[model samples]
Target: MAARREQDFHWAAVDRGELVVQQCRQCAKLRHPPLPRCAACGSLDWHEHPLSGLGRIISWVILTHPGGKDAVRRTGILVELDEGIRVVSNLVDQENAAIGARVRVEFGEPGPQRLALFRTLAETPA
Candidate 1:
């Protein structure tokens, strides 16, 4: 999967312990989950820009199902970064989470793969 040219930029950054997204050179639009062309300007040329590692929890779900090897209770969270892009990652070391909570991105090396996770800076609920 790393051989895909479109995802190379994202995986390359994640491999180095950083979060990045595709930015269109023409319209200055940012695209995540990397695409072949910019949806805003239809430009195929783009670059990767590192994020601030700051975000806010917009929504989340905790899975309690059991699995084979890596089956553990995990919280899947949707973080809206300060840059206006939303990334889907897991909440590490958190038993519960709240919406609208402030969060920060953290890179984790779980097993042989590296992943981006979020931790709530403030678990404020309204």
Candidate 2:
């Protein structure tokens, strides 16, 4: 497969335990899955803006497919970050998750690389 080239700047931040998004220098719009040019202004120049790593679960699903013995079940969630960008990551340290549940980021160094994972915040009794 061909290299993406855009996530280069993004992974650098992830390795450092920080999540960043590309913001167009010309239009000031933040973009995830970083791209080379701005969608709004088509500006090549941009900056890496750090995110708060706080978000809510917009949606989620559990994966139980076959991936050999090494396959551990996981929940993939669409997190709507506080900065307004929606990110796809795994929801960990919990049993079942719900839509609209708040989450906080947790850095995981699974191997040589680091990734941003999330955990559900404790829900208050209503």
Candidate 3:
């Protein structure tokens, strides 16, 4: 499969330091990995809904690229947003990572492209 032009808005928003998901115009259901049509209502009409950039780590995994010139390891996390949307993003600050840790979106240049990575939220002084 190849990248679709419909997804350009997503990367463009990321470039602008904004996180967004596609909201179906018909059913108002939000979905990540922007699709051309809504799976729920089969509606082609949709709009970009800005995310809170807040979520909790529901799951995670450490991925190691073995047997490659650029072999490296990184932690990937599955976060369920406060709005109930689940997104897969990489964790930057892996120090206090836990399954239910609170995290927020942080943009970073992994290579030449800006991407939405995440990090554990700082604990408040009590």
Candidate 4:
């Protein structure tokens, strides 16, 4: 299946300001990076399971563009959600970006497209 068709549900959910994981309808197993079939049960049936939007940074890296004047630096992270599903997204604020740092997902500023980004829990106001 084409990538867009397989991930339409996920991107749509994100656009609605929610995060979701693909769950195997038959086995009830959860997976990210949506797929046409479940790896665990080999079932093509699945549903979008809304996530808590909570996770911890497991790893991260700094990406730097090579262009001189137009250079840009962004932090890319791998987050392991509370549900144990891992998601790859950009770090929004990039403060307190460390392994095991708790984070929450937030959508990027409104634009032509929105993205799932993360910020450290500590940075969030109580």
TM-score of each: 0.86, 0.86, 0.88, 0.86
Model 1: per-residue Cα lDDT over 1-126, one tens digit each:
446678876777888888999899999998887899999989998988889988788889876655444455678888889999999989985665888888888888755778888887754644
The weakest ten consecutive residues by lDDT in model 3 span 64-73
lDDT of each: 0.83, 0.85, 0.87, 0.86
The residue-level lDDT of candidate 3 at 115 comes to: 94
The C-alpha local distance difference test score for the whole of candidate 4 amounts to 0.86
What value does the lDDT take at residue 71 in candidate 3?
48
Select the stronger candidate by lDDT from 1 and 4.
4
Rank ordering of all candidates by lDDT, starting from the highest: 3, 4, 2, 1
Q: Please identify model 2 stretches exceeding 4 Å from their true place.
A: 1-4, 66-70, 123-126
Residue 3 lDDT in candidate 1: 64
Candidate 3 or 1, higher TM-score: 3
For model 4, residues 44-121, the per-residue Cα lDDT tens digits are: 999889999998899998876666532446789999998999999888877677888889999985346888899898
Using TM-score as the measure, name the better of candidate 2 and candidate 3: 3
* lDDT leader: 3
lDDT-wise, the better of 2 and 4 is: 4
Quote model 1's TM-score. Answer: 0.86
What tens digits encode model 3's per-residue C-alpha lDDT throughout 1-126?
976688888999999999998999999999887888899989999999999999899988886666553444578999998999999989998766688888999999987899999988875311
Q: Total backbone clashes of model 1?
A: 0
